[model samples]
Target: MPTAAFTTLGCKVNQYETQKILESFEAQGFEIVPFDSPADVYVVNTCSVTQSAEAKSRQTIRRAARQNPNAIVVMTGCYAQFTLRRGETLAEAHLVVPNPDKLRTVEYVLEHFPHLKAQLEQARQRGETPVRRRSRAVLKIQDGCNIYCSFCSIPYTRPVMRSVPYQDVLEEARAMVADGYREIVLTGVLIGDYGAATGSGGPDLAELCAMLTAIEGLERLRISSIEPTQVTDHLIELTATNPKMCPHFHIPLQSGDSRVLKAMNRPYDQAFYLELIQRIRARIPNCAISTDIMVGFPGEDEAAFQNTCKVVEQVEFCRAHLFRYSPRPDTPAEAMRDQVPEPVKSERIQQLQQVAKAAARRYAARFIGTTERVLVESRSKLSGLMTGTSDHYLQVEFAASPSLAGQLVHVRITDLTPDGVLGELVALQ
Candidate 1:
C-alpha cells in the first residue's frame, strides 16, 4: 500500500480538515505513516496566520522534502490558498493541489496514482471504520472569517464566511460521538458569523447548539472562540440550559481603550465588553471566561497600556492570551503611524503575561476540592502523569493508567499550580 503522512499547522479548522483528509487516504488503502518517516506522499496543511506561522510552514515543507525527496509533497490550507502574492511555489509536489475541496483532494491523489486503484477498490468494498480521535475532537462547522479586523490577515487569506450545511454538521457530530469522542469543539475562523453568508439562514449558532445537544452520548460540546458582539441572548440562554455545552467562553477582547479599539477597527469598546461579561456571569456564575488581549498596537502609549491593565483588573478574565501586536505585511494597522517600539511591545507583553498568569492561578484555585468532570487527554511527557481538561477548561493532572485516556472522569481539584491544576481522580462517573 502507498504510505502517506501529514503535517497540519494553524487553527482547529485546519486540523479538523487534515483529519478528514487522513480518513479519506486510509479509505483508499494509504498506510498512514509518521510525518518524519519516509512515505509515498507528504501532505503539509499550512497556516499563514502570522509571518512566523508561514515560516514554520515553509520549514515543515523543507523537512518533508528531506525525509523523502521523491515523495509527492502536497501543500494546502491558508498559505497555499494565498501563495500567489507571497511568491511561494510548491515545486516539491508532483501534483500541487492548492486549496482543493478536501474530499476532492483525496480523490485526486487516487486518480493521479493509478497503481493504487485495486487497493482503493478493495478498501472501499470493506468500508472504512470510524477512526477514534484523541481527547478533543475539533468539528469544523464553519469556515472563513468575514469580519476583517484591521490588524488581521486571515480575511485576506480565507475570505468569505461559509458554513457547512446544518445537516452535514449534525452528521459529523454523530460520527464523532460514535467514534468515542467525549468532547466536540466547534471551530471556525469566525464561527459566530456562521449562517450569515448562506441564504438558508435556517440555523444560527444557537439553533446549531440545540441540534448538537440532541445528539446522544456526546458528553461535551464547546465553542473554540467567538467575538463579544456575536454572543447573542439566545446563544447565552442556550449555553446556560444545555448540559452538553462546556462552561467556558473564550471571547477576544483586543483592547479595553476605545481609541485603541477604533484604531484597530474593532467594533466594541470596554464598556460593551464588560457588560457582555456581566450578562454571561449572571446567566452562568461559574463560567470560565477567557480572552485574547493584544498589547502594543500602533500608537498605544503609557496611558493606553494603563487603561488595558485597569480593564484586566476590573473584568478579571479567567485567562488571557497576551500577544505583542506584530505588524503583518499588507495589514491596515501595519502602515499606521506611531508604531510601538519593539522594546516597549516586549516589555508590555511580559507585564500582561504576568497579570494573565495571576488571574489564571486565582481562577484555578477557586476549583480546588470541587469534583469537576474532566476528559482525560494524554499522559504527561514531563512526569508520566495523566492529564485532562475540566468542563470549565482547567488543565488537571493526576496519576492514571494510559487506559484512562479519552475517558470522562470526575477529578477533585486538590492543588493549584501556575501551569496546571493538580487533581485526584474521585470517580469515573
Candidate 2:
C-alpha cells in the first residue's frame, strides 16, 4: 500500500485539520507513516504564527523532501496560504494547497499523482485495514477569527468567519465516540465566536459542549483555547458541573501589562484576567489553567515585563507557553516604535521562563498526594511508564499495560516530574 506522513505546526485548529486530512487519505487507502520515515507522500500543515514557526515550516518541508527524495511533498495551512497569497512558491513542495483549499488536500493529491489513484483502487479491492493514529480526536466546531490582534497574521490568513452546524457537530461527535475515541478536543481559529456570523442555526459554544457531553461514550471534552474576553459565565458553570467537560482551560494571556494588552488589541486587561482565573478556580477545584505569554512586544519595557511577572506570580498557571514576539509583515505591531532589542528580548524571555517554571512547579506541588482521574493516552518514552492526561489537563505517568491506553484510571500523585506529575495506578475509576 502507498504510505503517507503528516506533520502539523501551530495551534489545535491546525492539528484538527491535519487529522481530518489524514482521515481523508486513509479513506482513499493510504497507509499512514511517521513523518520522519520515508513515505510515498508527505503533507506538511504549516504555521506562520511567528518567524520561528515559519522557519520550522520551511525546515519541515525540506526534511520531508530529504526523507524520500522521490516522495510527493504537499504544503498547506497558514504559511502556505501566506506564500500563495503573495504569489510566492515553495520549491520543496510538489503541490501547495491554500488555506481555503486545505480540506481538499486529498483531492489535490490524487489529481497530482494519477498512479496513486490506481493504487488506492487496488487497495480497496484487497480490502486491507487502513492505518490510523491518535486515541483522542480533535473536532473543529468553528473557523476564522474576527479579532485582528495587532501582532497576529491569522486574521489575515483566515479572514472568513463561519461555524459548523450544530447537527453536523453532534453527528461527528457521535461518530468519533463510536470509533472508540474517549476524548474530543474542540478547536477553531476563534472558537468563542461560534454561532455568531454564519447563522448556521447551531448552538453557541456552551450549548454545543452541553450537547457533546450527553454523548453516551464520550468520556472527555476539551476546549482547545479561548479568548479571555470570550470565556462566558455559562461555559464556566457548565465545565464546573459537567462530568465530561475537562476541568482544564487554556486561555491565552498574551501579555499582562495593560498598555501592552491595549497595543496588542486584546479586549481584557490584567485585572480582568486575574479575576477570571480566580472565578474558574473558585468554581472548579483542581482546575488546571494554562496560558500563552508573549515576551518582548514592541513597547514591552522593564515595567511592562515586570507587570507580566506579577501576573504570572498571581495566577500561577499550571502551564505557560512562552515565546518571544516576532513581527509579522503588514501588521500594525511591525511598524510600531520601541521594538525591543534582540538581546533584551532574550533576557526577558529567560526571566519570564523562570517565573513560569516556578509557578508551574508550585501549582503542581499542590496536587501531590491527591488522586486524579487520568485517561491513558500512551506510554512515556523518557521513563517507560504509562502516560495520559488528568481531567485537569495534567500530564500523568503511571504503570499500566498497553491495553489501558484509552481507559480512564485512578492515579495517586506521588511526585512532580519536570513535565508533569508521576503517579501510581490506584484503580480504574
For each candidate in turn, the TM-score is 0.81, 0.89
Error of 1 at 345 (Å): 1.8
Candidate 1 regions off by >4 Å? Answer: 1-8, 25-44, 55-76, 80-97, 101-134, 156-159
lDDT at residue 281 of model 1 (Cα atoms)? 87
- Model 1 agreement with the true structure over 73-108: per-residue lDDT tens digits: 777777777685566576664555667665467777
Q: Please provide, for model 2 over 90-137, each residue's C-alpha lDDT reduced to its tens digit, 9 standing for 90 to 100.
A: 788999998888989999999989999998888788887774544689
| Deviation of model 2 at 35, angstroms | 4.0
Which pairs clash (backbone N, Cα, C closer than 3 Å) in model 1? none
TM-score, cand. 1 vs. native: 0.81
**Superposed Cα deviation of residue 101, candidate 1 (Å):** 6.6
Give the Å error, residue 52, model 1.
3.3
Q: What lDDT would candidate 1 get against the real structure?
A: 0.81
